[model samples]
Target: MCVQAISNPRSEDDQEKAWQAVCPLVNQLRNYYEFSIALEAVVVDLLSVLCSDEMTSRQHLEMQQSLFKQFAEILDFTLKFDDLKMTNPAIQNDFSYYRRTLSRMRMAGGDDIDKDLDVNNDMANRMSLFYAHATPMLRMLSDNTTKFVSQNKDLPVENTTDCLSTMACICRVMIENPNYRSKFSSEETVLFCLRVMVGAIILYDHVHPVGAFAKSSGINIKSSIKVLRDEHPGKVEGLLNALR
Candidate 1:
């Protein structure tokens, strides 16, 4: 219902209400492992809506803060979800089942297709843009989190550390897994991973007292770099650009 309301709001007020209603739900749902795929689909849809060019300038201005908050929430959930899925093999099985079901529904010309699981072309395009190197979402995450830490000096750094560590882990997993590396056929996907890996290292350095390069850092930076160097010898330019 919240998704429907957000997608086809009857009024500007209604749209705002829908976003307000769904933001917390998005945040909460990340903790539930069984709903990982559902949460992933919802995040993609919400991002497409949030990043749409159809909104008027005035509406965009009015909702700027809300948009940032939503993006932060989405980013947080994404990192947490990625971390969970890395440890749980069942998440992939669940996603495979969903794909099979969606495929069957498409083949049957069924009207009963699960709207939540099915991503339309437009949404997929927007999702692609979101992970691109030029994405505004990355800038937003950097700016918002920097400002947040500056203002909230009393807050614990553990959460931020965990987020960065999860990013590093994701980068490592992608580099180590041949199947995952094969999926990075697009330059954008490769750049996206490089950017995350680089950003994670830099931020992890700043946040962790001993730095991300320390022996006790837990993040295997040396091995990750070695794997990238050995496997992706051709992506040197992309890696340099990402580091820069």
Candidate 2:
């Protein structure tokens, strides 16, 4: 309902209200791992609406902060969810069930099926792009989290350390897996992986006592770099840009 309101709002006030209502739920995604697939769909829907050209310049300016906040949350959730899914078979089961149900609904042409459950072409494209590059979103998250930690020095270093470590590990796993590396068919996706890997290394170096270069860091940085370099010889510009 909130998504519908935001997508087809009668007024600017209505859309803003819808977003306000939904933002809290989005912020709590880490607590709702079982529903990650469904929640991901919702997040993608909202992102597509916000990023679409249909939004006016005025709305873009008005919602700029909200948009960035949403992006950061999406990035964090995507990484965390990917990490969890790697360890938990249940997450894949949930996604399979979701796909089957959606397929059944389409096959039956059920009028009773909620339109919101349907993945429109635009939303599908957005979802693919999100999992592909998401560099812009990662940058937003990096900037916001840096600002936040600076403002809240009293925040536990352990919490920050764990978060950055998990992000780095996830990036390494995705890059090292041959199947996953094969999916990086686009330059954009390759660049996204490089950016996240480099960003994670830089941040983890700062937070981890021994630094990301340490063998005990558990990041397997050399192997991951080797995989990327061997698979994407033409991505030298991408790597250079990531370093920059």
Best by TM-score: 1
Ten-residue segment with the worst summed lDDT in candidate 2? 1-10
Off by over 4 Å in 2: 1-154, 183-185, 237-244
Reference-based TM-score of each model: 0.38, 0.36
What TM-score would candidate 2 get against the native? 0.36
Instruction: Report, for every candidate in turn, its global Cα lDDT versus the true structure.
Output: 0.49, 0.49
Kindly report the root-mean-square deviation of model 2 from the true structure over all alpha carbons.
Answer: 19.0
lDDT of 2 by residue, 95-130 (tens): 333334445555778644545533433333444344
Candidate 1, residue 6: lDDT: 26
How close is each model in CA RMSD to the real structure?
Answer: 18.9, 19.0
Candidate 1, residues 1-244, lDDT tens digits: the string is: 0111124446758745654544443333223422533444454444344434555423443566465345445554444334343445433333333334345545776644435332433333443343232323334344444544455466455545555565566666886678998888776565456545665665566657687778998578787576557645554443433333
